[model samples]
Target: MKYIALFRGINVGGNRKVDMKQLRTLFESLGFSQVSTYINSGNILFESELDTKSVLMKIQNCFHNTFDFEIPTIVKTENEMKKIAKSIPEEWQNDPTQRTDVAYLFPEADSKKIIEELPLKIEFLEIRYIKGAIFWNIKRENVNKSQLAKLISHKLYKSMTIRNVNTARFLAGEKE
Candidate 1:
């Protein structure tokens, strides 16, 4: 199976620095094939026969052992990513006036419960959920008014790893 592992909070603000080269090496060392990293934010694309659950377990253990730190990792199969990318409207993007984000939720928390918890301000938000993730958008100017913008302080935030639409598209193989 092919999987994309999105590591949260790494290489941010000079904290938890992860070198992509070493990351690739680490994934490769796990016996995964075609291990490759996307950007410096810790998105890794790799293939393995192991199931997604098994893959996540192996990567989490290996990552902590190799990097000496623990960070939440969200894994999605290539098919799942493709569906997510396809679900996104063509117009939503991370640009001058609009911002789109897909929050890949951890297994324990990927549910309608979190979606229900969102106090969405329709004027500033557009949100939807399908299985493992939630897609949301907010006008850049009204970002502060969007519940998603303040999600960082919400307890449910810890259960998700967010990516901008651009990153999501690239990972889903929608961008070259």
Candidate 2:
């Protein structure tokens, strides 16, 4: 099956540096096929007969053993990723004025609980839960003032990985 693996907290702020080339080599060595990485932010596409959970665990363990850093990995089938990409609200698509992001929730995460924990409402922010992911939009103009910024320190933040709408779409093969 074709899948996309999203790695969290790598190659950011000069921390947890992981070479994409080496990552591809590792995946290849692990018996995956057609492995490819995008942009250096730990997005990998590959084909494997292994189940999603097994793939996720294998990558995470391999990465930690090789790099000495714990990298959380999320694996989703191509169809799942495509569904996620298409789930974005129509109004958020191609809108330059809005900063849209999709938060991939951990397998153990409770989407309903997370949503309930978030602020009751924020005028400049819109959030939706779909298929174990959180789709959110923040007006660019209000980014600095939006309470969504507080998410960084929120406990739930550690349980999910965020990707920009464009990156998410690209990984989903919605864009060439």
Candidate 3:
């Protein structure tokens, strides 16, 4: 299946650096084909016959063996990703210019738990849980400033990755 693997803590601040070449090689070792990376921050798109969880574990193992590190990897199938895109809050959709982000959550999370505890200090930013991901309508000013970002990381227990709305759109196959 075609899937997007969102890797955490790679190529950040020059630490945990992973070259796109080696990244592609790791995935290829796992028997994934058509592998491609976007930007420098470990947004990988590839196809594999393994299940999502196994894919995650295999990548994690490969990372540890190759780089001596354990990086969190979240894998989502193309269909599930489509559901996530559809789950974005309507208000955010109407105003694309607003600074926004999408936090991809673990597939097994309890949605109700997240909704109840969402941070609300940032008025312009809101969160929606669709399928297994959190779609955030982050105000541009509040994008990097809001407590919601921290809340998401905390609430999700660092099992998620926050990518800018534009990047998310591109990964989701939306036109610029």
Candidate 4:
């Protein structure tokens, strides 16, 4: 299976630094082939015979052993990533007018009917939930006024690994 491992909170603010070359080596050491990293935010794409759960467990175990920190990871199949990217409207690009993001939720996180659960009462905030992630778009000018702006402080934020729409497109093989 081809898997994309979205690791959370790594290589941020010069902390939890993980070199792309070393990260590739780490994945390769676990018998995964075609391992490659994108943009150094711990997005690893690779092939393995094991299922998604098995791959996640192996990576987490070896990752902590090698790096000495537990990485909160969400593993998605290539098709799933593509679906996530496809679900977003074409107009929801991050630009001067609006910002779009995909919050890839952890497996243990309760994502079902998340749109109704999330605090999206603001008029400028647009939110949608599929199986594995939440797609949100907010007007840039109104972001500060919207409850979505405080997602970082929200409880659901703890269970998510967010990426911009462009990153989501790239991960889905829909872009450069």
Best by lDDT: 1
- Report model 3's TM-score to 2 decimal places: 0.82
The better candidate by TM-score, 1 or 2, is 1
Residue 100 displacement (Å), model 3: 1.2
Worst window of 10 by summed lDDT in candidate 4: 108-117
In model 3, state the lDDT of residue 98.
76
What is the C-alpha lDDT profile of model 2 across 44-67, one tens digit per residue?
999999999898878877876898
lDDT of 1 at 155: 81
lDDT of 4: 0.87
Runs off by more than 4 Å, candidate 1? none
Candidate 4 Cα outliers beyond 4 Å, as residue runs: none
Per-residue lDDT tens digits for candidate 1, residues 25-111, read: 988989999999999998999999999889999988887777777888988999999998899999999889999999998888888
TM-score of 2: 0.93
TM-score of each prediction: 0.93, 0.93, 0.82, 0.93
Poorest stretch of ten by lDDT in candidate 3 = 88-97
List the pairs of residues colliding in candidate 2.
none
C-alpha displacement of 100 in model 2, angstroms?
0.5
Model 4 shows how many backbone clashes? 0
Sequence-dependent TM-score of model 4: 0.93
The alpha-carbon lDDT assigned to residue 101 of candidate 3 equals 67
